[model samples]
Target: MDLVTLTVDVVIALWVVAVVVGIVRAIKARPPRLAPLPEQIRNRFEVGWERISGRFLYEPQWAVGEADSLVMSLLSARGQPLDHARLPREMQQARHDAAAAANGRPRDKTEAMRQVLLQYRTVFERNLGPKPRRTAPVPRREVA
Candidate 1:
């Protein structure tokens, strides 16, 4: 529109942008408590809500659990035919055989299946580890 109107609008927009950026930077920096009202208040406004929600939500958690299950199933094979429960068991066996054809060396069928499983194993290896033992030291004898 007119120059006066556009300049006022530009000033207001600049002020709004400055406020937003200042707020974000304050949250990230966690400014000193000695500062005055607004800046001090801004320091407490931490932001990681999205990341916290992502890990806890149903779909993400379920997918992570499935990756864990796949790893467990593969490790159980350990280069042998897994004694899987029957029914689509025959079909799964055939699928493993077909996949072996694609690999340069013809892998043992179980190893072929385990390779598929290694994708999930990598996830388990990265994310989870065994719990530490609660080892208490034995009491020292008081010599006579």
Candidate 2:
């Protein structure tokens, strides 16, 4: 074959290999599915969610503690190690200061509370079961 034809062939072969590798990696990269939550634990998480959602706005300190408590509870129920639930050092200090400050400012407390809520949700979901699938909302049919 001519030099130009030989180069073209090589390039085509490389392109095909690249495409196949990309497809294979894409397939392997999919997240592993999580198991479903047990009914009892799901109920517990739901209750905790309600309490935190209700009180977080008005009572930031209490909400932060509640979030931590919820994570602890889930760990207890699952018989997991407790250290996994502990807040980071900075967060711990922030929480402590928030507690000590009489008439604590909500701004500082709110950031800590938000972190706690995020931690709780992550820990709760990890222990509870597989991630829930998100479904698209169904469109309503208009009557003619």
Highest TM-score model number: 2
Q: Residue by residue across 1-144, what tens digits does model 2's lDDT show?
A: 999999999999999999999999887555334445677677878788788868877886677677667766665565543452343343345445445542546566567566556655665566666545668999999999
Q: Which window of 10 residues has the lowest lDDT sum in candidate 2?
A: 81-90
Model 1 over residues 1-144: C-alpha lDDT tens digits? 999999999999999999999999877555223222233222222122223224433443333344444433433322223334321233344345435534535435334444434444443343233433558999999999
lDDT of each: 0.42, 0.64
Off by over 4 Å in 1: 1-113
Q: Tell me how many clashing residue pairs each candidate has.
A: 0, 2
What is the overall TM-score of model 2 with all chains considered together? 0.46
The weakest ten consecutive residues by lDDT in model 1 span: 40-49
